[model samples]
Target: MSVPAVETAPLLNTPLYDLHLRLGARMVPFAGYAMPVQYPAGLLKEHLHTRAAAGLFDVSHMGQVALRAADVTEAARALEALVPADILGLKPGRQRYGLLTDARGGILDDLMVANLGDRLVLVVNAANKAADLAHLRAGLPDSVAVEELPRALLALQGPGAEAALARLAPEVAAMRFMDARVFDILGAACLVTRSGYTGEDGFEISTPEDAAAPIAEALLADPAVLPIGLGARDSLRLEAGLCLHGSDIDTTTSPVEAGLGWAISPARRRGGARPGGFPGAERILAEMEAGPARRRVGLLPEGRVPVRAGAALFAEGGETAIGHVTSGGFGPSLGAPVAMGYLPAGLAASGTRVFAEVRGQRLAAAVAPLPFVPAGFKRG
Candidate 1:
């Protein structure tokens, strides 16, 4: 999807705005920020480079919020009331994906919750940060304080991320997926997490805003690490079957319907030890057991035509619409067009044939497993 153009001026800029311009980046408005959509190498090259080596991405527009209380247990329990994850059981220095939901079991936003020893750090979506902060403050007790950190976030992703990052912070090489730690790189303190959105072996570094440029430049100095922009980032995550906040998921999609039920811990499920204390727990838990009417599924279009978002889906040989694509694009790694959208439960199985209406033509598509390109996460 192309980044939307801004009609008005005065959009927020990240600390790397100057550096982006210097690198010949194509700037565009996204989530109220003038972010780099692509560099001179373009999205295709950037995407391919990340898959083969590493790509350094400036993701400072994302929100970094910290929750603190007298103890970690107290803070985790308070946070559990708002999200469906089992925060209280989260181990120290570990992170987990979670969803902030509404009372009706719809997703408000998806976020990353990391147990930062004495406190919890939340990485929320840029577009929903204000609302997510407000929600966090309103849900937590007085003892649990929610504070947004004035920091810049960077992601070093793909297969070569480990080698590039280890050159600066050698200890980071020991950490597995979802592990987090504080490290000093070039005398600058940074909180590094072994996680990212691209379904690759990578790390996300959160540092003081003032150090953003220096850190980014240091990472890009490596031959294997090239600066990546938002265009490739969106395509990478899309090919990984990850949901975009406002597009693939929103206030109307439930975690179960989105095929993110694994994010809801077993301990928080019905009949578990700490069952159903979050918002929409009743409906969420009920759906967990009974199943949702429709579910998100991966679609592999038969031909080279790329199906885009909002394209209607239809049943075989029937004009009646079954669903619509939420995120669709060409998967450079898979060498084919890939998409994801909601489909009836009965027709969501892999190998189930369907059709997508693109430009008045019904193109044949097949229901396939998610992550059009296999994930390369370092689980151990």
Candidate 2:
């Protein structure tokens, strides 16, 4: 007997697309979805609003997957073996950021993992979702079940995020940073965690795909919450000293070189001890001890000129190219040109003077500590 041809389904839209259109959002294609790049209110206002008050962002494009195993301990072990983070030490209801690597130690993608009772949940970047799923499935045992959560994820972030979310989800008022819990908002159940990529005290709410419209409408009904776009999201994270997957760091960069060695635990670093599985162990462990030849650093431009990605950095003489900018832009919070790039280890000091070639002109720049704006996460 002949088998029937399977029909391919069209790309799914988030429940908020209609609302986005009604709000005059300039829709763009991103991660296989029609998303808003900016709205009628514009990007600058959105960026400033997010820093000063609350900005609601739809990050539902990110992949949400859960790993189910026999028990928590075994699940943690299996996961720890794959990533460098100390998952075994992760307390219940807490989350940690980690990277997945290939055998040669190249990054597959950076992700956030949460200990959700007996199962572990992961939120990975949208661009690398397919590759990440393939990587996970190949590495994990057959007994472990992987379930993808196709839902809308929203982030209400800024200094005033807690106050805004509390108006709708009162239980979030007492939630601690990195803690996850199930809460009801406007009569709809959702997974809310006091976490964000903007280095602020915020909440990431995962709601049913179908209920996204109602849930967003309920929260946005508040006067304080405004819709933000990707343009502002990049600037906000950059100002917060966060890394962008393909830009600031990529498959070519190791955690050590990316200045993320803190993600590795002591148990994983002990001499002669086998750290859990993933990829690039020998080189990664070695770089952890000896340090990387090039390190990611923060830069401040001297003049009114703003440096951009791929701009070449030079030593004091401005003749020899030493490094290049990965992510760069005018930081609205800093009110100046702030950027991040990889430079030779020797020149990666706080006070080291450097130069960047922008528009054929060499501009004086200095190495500055990351997080041009201080993080205001509500730790308690």
Candidate 3:
């Protein structure tokens, strides 16, 4: 089922909105835009198809921003002040995952930062792009320019993505994970990155807005490429244990507590040259030294029933609620129910038995390792 729109405000449409309709997509509202929830083939087939072959996703609604300082190094330093990652040390033609943190030590947003040859580019969530833009503008020095890019983003994912994209830009076949470069496709200058949200080997293509439809058309012309929608995207990311902002991690969750400690650069930690500059660095560094009070972990429900978000977690026989599910659904890949939630550090171990309160009944569940499905990134 697709998430419906209830907002009174008029919703926006992406560059591929018309193409989606033409392809028989079941349009639904997501992040204030009319997006496809699934195509004629439906969500289940789309999910399994992506795991086996290839799936094309329209993600143009996401925000694209470019940062420019006097020089590339200056731009990296300017961005380093805002994110936990070591942007100053980032090399050209590479990208890294970063977090925008608030003074309270909570994550404001999760984003991808790429070191373009002359500037740096950031890809932020659609729901938080406005706020993220405002934050960047206000925080960065006046000399630095924070400009939004009007580009369309598309994701081609699965084990076959490499071959599919290589047909158009042969150079992409040699790129490894997190590599970013520019290529000419259909007379358009495109920024191609070897990265994706799905736990599959894939590539994210950022191209001109006007060329989106035809580019999508060209890709769909291939038999292996199927149009996937938000429904399958959600289930795929869940099985991959990827956190969705506003659902799994939010203003109240810290990166350490959210099982994202690795995103923090070592140079930003205590006893380093550039230590303690970012917002909430004090608390974040402290949490690194002494573990957080609670931790995010995976949950496996014993039965076939789907456990959804907001279900409260409890001790097997205890009455008081300890935590609640942040993201949950039936894992199409596993043929079982999977979820993720926060719990006291003591109870966060794998195989720890717990119960979730669902409609007045306690269902048995156990803490499991994250990524119910293993990640298939081409790290080489």
Mark the 10 consecutive residues where model 3 has the least summed lDDT: 271-280
Tell me the tens digit of each residue's lDDT in model 1 across 1-380: 99998677578999999999999999999888999999999999999999999999999999999999999899999998999898989999999999999999999999999998899999999999999999998889999999999999999999999999999989998999999899998788999999998888899999998888988898899999999999999899988899998888998889999999999999999878889998899988998999999999999999999999999999998879999999998988888999999999999999999999999999999999988878898888
Candidate 2 stretches with Cα past 4 Å from truth are 1-12, 271-276
Report clash pairs, candidate 2: 81-276, 81-277
With candidate 2 superimposed using the best TM-score fit, by how many Å does residue 278's alpha carbon deviate from the native?
3.6
Model 3 Cα lDDT, one tens digit per residue, 1-380:
99997769788999999999999999988999999999999899999999999999999989999999889898889887888899988889999999999898999999999999799999999999999999999999988899999999999999989888888889999899999999998889999999999899999999999988888899998899999999999999999999999999998999999999999999889987688799889888899999999999999999998889999999877889999999999899899999999999999999999999888889999999999999999998
Per-candidate TM-scores read: 0.97, 0.94, 0.97
The TM-score between candidate 3 and the true structure equals 0.97
Superposed Cα deviation of residue 172, candidate 1 (Å):
0.6
Give lDDT per model, in order.
Answer: 0.93, 0.85, 0.93
Query: How far off is residue 212 in model 1, in Å?
Result: 1.1
- Please give the TM-score that candidate 1 achieves against the real structure: 0.97
Q: After superposition, how far is residue 310 of candidate 2 from its true place, in Å?
A: 1.0
